[model samples]
Target: MGISNILEPIQIGSMTLRNRVLMGSMHVGFEKLEDGVERLAAFYAERARGEVGLIVTGGAAVCQEGGMGDQYCNVYMDEHIEPLRVITAAVHEAEGKIALQLFHAGRYTNQDATGVESVAPSALQAPINRHKPREMNATDIERTIQSFADGAVRAKKAGFDAVEIMGSEGYLINQFLSPVTNKREDEWGGDFTRRARFGVEVSKRVRAAVGPDFPVIFRMSGLDLVPDSTTMEETLQFAVLIEQAGVSALNVGIGWHESKVPTIAMMVPRGAYVWVAQQVKEAVKIPVIASNRINDLRQAEAIIQEGRSDMVSMARPLLADSQIVRKSREGLFDEVNTCIACNQACLDHIFDGKIASCMVNPVVGREKEWALIPAEVSKKVAVVGAGPAGLEAARVLAERGHQVVIFEKQNQVGGQLNYARQVPGKEEFNETLRYYRAQLDKLGVEVRLETAATADSLSDEGFEEVVVATGVIPRRPEIPGVDLPHVVSYDRVFEKQAKVGRRVAIVGAGGIACDLSHLLVQDQVVSPQSAQYLLEYRILDAKAVHHLQQSGRKVYMLRRGKHVGTGLGKTTRWAVLANLKRHGVEMVTQIDYKEITAEGVIIRNQEEEQLVQADTVIIAAGATSNDSLYHALQGSLPVHLIGGAKEAGELDAKRAIYEGAAVGRAI
Candidate 1:
């Protein structure tokens, strides 16, 4: 097995996979109704056809009360067995095996939605999961164990090849395993071995119910990633006992629901939990499955080839692109709708009770409803600027049979989007760029680089429609000291202007400031030569709560008012605050910056006057649109201004893609 080699056949109990890829469990809100058999079957079947070796159906609650997490979760009812059969049959038809990961929402289930009392191993409730949980009586515990065993039997009857017991996440089983949540002194708590008793018993009952050949995957968090929760070391030791109880495989996961920086899910890195998986893999001979932000095929292959884990699994990746397996096989990898891990549509919208849709692929859940077979229209069009808006506009127009011409002033296609990929944590921005590049290429759209479109430079275009997607520029504040030698912005840092000193202070709290913080934390800051392209950002909310502030880096979030970071999205805001809080970055909120100098910044916070030191000053105040071209060309045609130019909307992929679609349809 070499590093360049691909994943080979692997065995997990009786069922074997031709490759080591499992279409990880991602609920597209497929079970909104009582019977989600057909919808779920169709969804899994699509991925199977795309060549996935294994399909783990989005979690099915083993019990009705205190079990389900969302409004659309599949139930473990006897009737649900019939639907499970349908899904298993569909996957088998496409030569893919299916596994049922039986789950119990435990305290994570919403009490408001269910109107049921949350039951846990103990009465201690999670701060974020604010449900008044009733301590599990002996009868409740016994019933839960029996219910899990029953669900495994039902899954077997439904034709699922295997069943994985859900112990990962901070669910019922994990809650019992966690010292933070479980405070019981009785049979199920106190000691580490005693704490793991519930999960161990559930596996024992499940194995007994399903018989000897049936493989049971024990899904447990490699690390809870929550304060005072179980770590990977605990998980490793916990696995040894669970394996002794007849577990066939271990499904390694990271973080709990409340954890903003999920161990495996975000923009952290590819295969972030491989080490955790490797640890368990080395300890166990039964094989281990690793899952967390594994989007790259090469990474997955390397994991298997290097024995990091027996297999790799993904949830959101399969939803964003059902044809990922087939596309990868056919070498159309870039064309696959990449999961940017933006929880906006998938988690946020679904929690809000809407269907799961991708920001890039609008036809995610409604793929059957909105699909174009591609028509050959013959209109010639010119798209200005090859940024997200322009790239998307040109791609869609060309797909509709229009002969499109896209012009970008920069050598690269992704304008500010390209620069954003260089920012830490926001690496998902790179995927958005790949999506557009692939989309435009497949549509046969002609992209012209280094072609800056002006009023006079509108040559090679005598078409029916012309789109001015030239994008926007940054706005400089009228403050007098902004023109100083040391003042710079995020754009300059991204462009990599040299001669910037080590210690830096970035001003601002919005997306620009957050990104600069990540960059400055990574030792990338603005220089004097590149100061023209930077932003002068100040903060609005500067309360550090995470360990990111411990990075030994100096970050002073300067604000003129009472609040900072008011513009960040809910989930994104939490992540930024968490990182900033952990890294020991000095935050100076509620301060008015009177001046910027080479040595430091002069500020005013309340009645006190203080000077903050910094070798380089990065500004992130905001951006201004160079919409002069849009105004000049507005009357020449029925033109539309969109995306950032429309309203300083950043490279928020949703805003850009959704707005681009509207512009295309309008045109």
Candidate 2:
């Protein structure tokens, strides 16, 4: 038996994994057109050194002529072989198996590469992809088949253990499979069988090209999850067909990029798509791999334990903490760097043509060379605030073998985190608090709760270094009736028994404001039992109009600016907007607040002035930096103010923690 039974070996055709840990395919964006192969090799080699059982090299485009995105790697031609050889050879040298996920983004291709003349199963254009595809003809189909075969042959020669066909998410194969998209009258359209023909044939050709010994992993959407999309029956049938078409296994996925929510990290819960994998596994004889939000080790064990799927795949989780596997094996799962799913650091950065960085763990993806543990030096350090920044700094300092003490005015750790965790879907942020607490205990850092430190106090203590992590304060908005007992700040919303009326109105469009809206709404939601587990929904039909809307909610937005919610990231923005729109939240932008009365909110918009009725009004405009402690201690002692004091973002948890880690390493 392997560590916690997670390292057990399984077969994909003749290829056997040393362990079930598969470093799922993720775009590193380090691949330049010229240095692509070398960069990819370096990326894979680093993962291989971490003992990644198998490596899936990002999403490699198969046809340079019609499919490619900016700074993306492509194995589209024989010219791409030698460079890919470097990748496979590097992985193998580290005693790891390497596979390539062959991709053709179709309409998802970039305009700069394909000249905007790309084609999907249908001619429908992506809302943001910007590329209008060239519809595929019989010759296009033939060339696509040849392209898959060519890419597969190159994979075999390059020594990939297998090749995963990128068949999900409204890509070419999925477009044909989807009824909402594929409207062609040709043999490739009309029915499920015909719709699956291209994928099945591509698998057959890829297998034939690579010989029977080489495996082909068919990645497909078991359920499109789109409105008016292909049914589950079609997906199951397609799964069986692909299995019989000589594919080694199926990598199950769900939904399309244009669905209610894309990007598995944001919307999907952990094990959110396990049922998809289970359905495919039950429908076919071949092994099935499950992915999409399966981040925790226990959840993964449950999937295999209950026979839901043969293996689990993780991308962002692995990226955030490459040592997760090793740590879990050693019963140190708490030490792992958890993914907050912010998308700001990882997805957004890489997409923006920068190296992928972690929101909290700044040293991520660079662990092979970059060390968060600074050089050996004995220094006494004092970190004030005991918050994300303080703890991160303390942990890093302790790791670097420095004597460190953290001071907090609060009785417990997690300053803002204690409050920030109040948001919906952000309950996991508490994991960081527990992680730091565990680090404090493990590394023996002295934590003095209720010990507020000043520059003079720290100087009297004779510490070598001082870091003021005393975070920010809520910026109070100037408005009438704000001082009344009926009006409470967002921090107080989740702190105590906030008696919000049936008609609740929240002001401000900041992260906390949006989150406070969700917190209040969820508090009002109802969950009825008809089947398995607990359920939840909103009460009073209140939507975070500024954040999102799933169903109709009577959410009132009082905006002081033009855009209601401008500060949110991509994933959060979509969710917030969709939720708000679905709930029919009322929007009143560019409003001057006249007053907050028991009767809703009275404000004047640029267009017109209106007094909306509200049971209660909550404020979430912005935060004020309570720099009194830092400023008082500033010149008095050598104090470095990092994080929120340096920049403004709620996830300053990330900013603060990274600063702490950097300072810890340096000291």
Candidate 3:
């Protein structure tokens, strides 16, 4: 289908966007560095150059007390104006429009970061926050409202194209909108109308301050996805009020931070929350933008053409590939590095209190430092593996005008990522492979599949630089009857080379084990389209579909360690574990492996021996570095090691890709 709807220009208030793609707001933890403003300006300028229709910057705190942290922009302070002005100028110079997102964390604020306790409409304790908030009095509420108005004034003075009032994702305004958090009987929280007064008043005040021409977008929660939250009717009513309050558009956000539903994980289907935005669009005359899990141009175009939304917002996809919009516009969809939504390097890092970057594109936050400039001197380079590390290294080397070749023993690339894609809900890994293939081919990198390059072969090729990213080999744990006919390695199971039985026992309770268990215990594989159809037609409710998604297969996972899924990211571990639990996969930690019998594996937990009844046993203990090739070529040639070859203690694709890119630049 031809792309037309998403590419169409849109007008919001007096600000006209070149296209419907909005680079959504994301906090990258770059707001408080000494040269933070300069870094941020460069970041936005890159996206602007890529021809994104509009950009809404990360939230800037409306007041000190409601601040996310010291790293966030405090618009309440006089010092913020100059920095914001610099950003707006940079964006405008690139011929792009930018919106400043006025923010307040409310009870989500960290006392350690703000040097004060969090304040909210009521003194409710948030599940995600440690600090119980102090209830805001009438004076506090009035002051907070004034602060939002003042922040809008600051944004306009800074030459911003528009301002987005941050009201969603269980922030300050969302707290007032939800009945679960706001228990106050005062004017602010007596009923639905009163509960929504805070956000409406803020929008009204911001509009009053910015004048009618300036764009005022309210990011309202379409569905809190929490218990006893605002109903859809109330949320739509809130949207109507916000529109009446003089907002130019409504950007619909789904789920609260404390909501159990996974909003932006790899498991979430694309455009999963679009219905929420459609409801808001129908409720109000103003344009509505759908957010969350809508990546790529096809999804965006369909959303706009179908009239479900007037626009679409993509935050992480832009981080993965700043040129997503431009590439799609030129019909170079294959070249665009789609966001896998693994959250390994972006959201996971943010939640870990570290600087955020992209797993695929490592140059995201370090754009200036990690630029792939042309090599001063080009040379013939040999990358001795076609996995993540080798693929990236080859791509970068070829891009810098170096003659590059990649050797892989397998018929295809992606290494362990192939297994990852085989797991349910991990279909996005194929995109990584697709991107690498496109990049390598475009850069003229030679790939030799089913051909493993040895030290002698590489030395004979007369390559100046050799990069050894040989990846890793699964560790074979020592146990009685380990090589039994019914026992299989995780790789064999993933490759379908070995047959799994009705009952299965898996060794090692790590990421691989959990994924394998999920795959084996699931009764049927539901494609995203089919799943959406099931829900849309009401053939099966979410709860019933969830029940049907799993099977009664007896799968047991055994781990020697005390914890399961040890190295998983904090944001994704819980969700993965929940899936395992929901599928009835029994995970036993602190177990002593006795032996592998024909019927099943024997384990001793808490000094009690028991037979885990299983027709097949699988081993997924861990991995060891495949550094034999690296060591072989060490003294024979000048070689660099990366990815699993450098460190196999933890299998990390994020570190692998980053290392490959860094090595490529250095060479």
| Candidate that scores best on TM-score | 3
Model 2, runs deviating above 4 Å: 1-4, 32-42, 113-116, 261-263, 350-354, 497-499, 524-555, 580-587, 597-600
* Ranking of all candidate structures by their lDDT, best first: 3, 2, 1
Clash counts for all predictions: 31, 23, 0
The residue-by-residue lDDT of candidate 3 on 1-667, one tens digit each, is 6678999999999988999999999988877667888788889999999999999999999998998777777699777899789999999999989999999999999888889778998898888888899999999999999999999999999989999999999999999989988999989997999999999999999999988899999999999999888998899899999999999999999988888889999999999999999988888898899999988898899999999999999999999999999999999999999999999999889888887899999998887677779999999999988889998899888898999989999999988888888888888999999999999989988889999888899999899989999988888999998999999999899888998888999999988898899889874757557878999999999987766666558899999999998878888888999988877899989989999999899999899999999998999999999999888887888899999988885568898999999999989
**RMSD to truth, every model:** 6.8, 4.1, 2.2
User: Whole-model Cα lDDT per candidate?
Assistant: 0.74, 0.74, 0.90
- Candidate 3 has a TM-score of 0.97
User: Residue by residue across 1-667, what tens digits does model 1's lDDT show?
Assistant: 2323344777888878777788776657766745455667777787888777788876788887655544545545787777567888888998888888888878787777666787888776667666768899999999999999999999999899988888887888999999988898999999888899999999999999999999888898788888888766778888898888998888887888777564533556777778988998887788788888887666687787777888888777887778876677666667877877767667766656666666666556654434444544566777777777777777767777778888788888987777768766777878778888888878788888987776555533555567776666665666657888788866787778734555677777666676667666654233423333332232212222122222346776765655555655545567766776665566667777788777788787777777788888777777776577678766565466766777675555566666666566555
TM-score of each: 0.84, 0.90, 0.97
Selected candidate, larger TM-score, 2 vs 3: 3
Q: What TM-score does candidate 1 get on C-alpha atoms?
A: 0.84
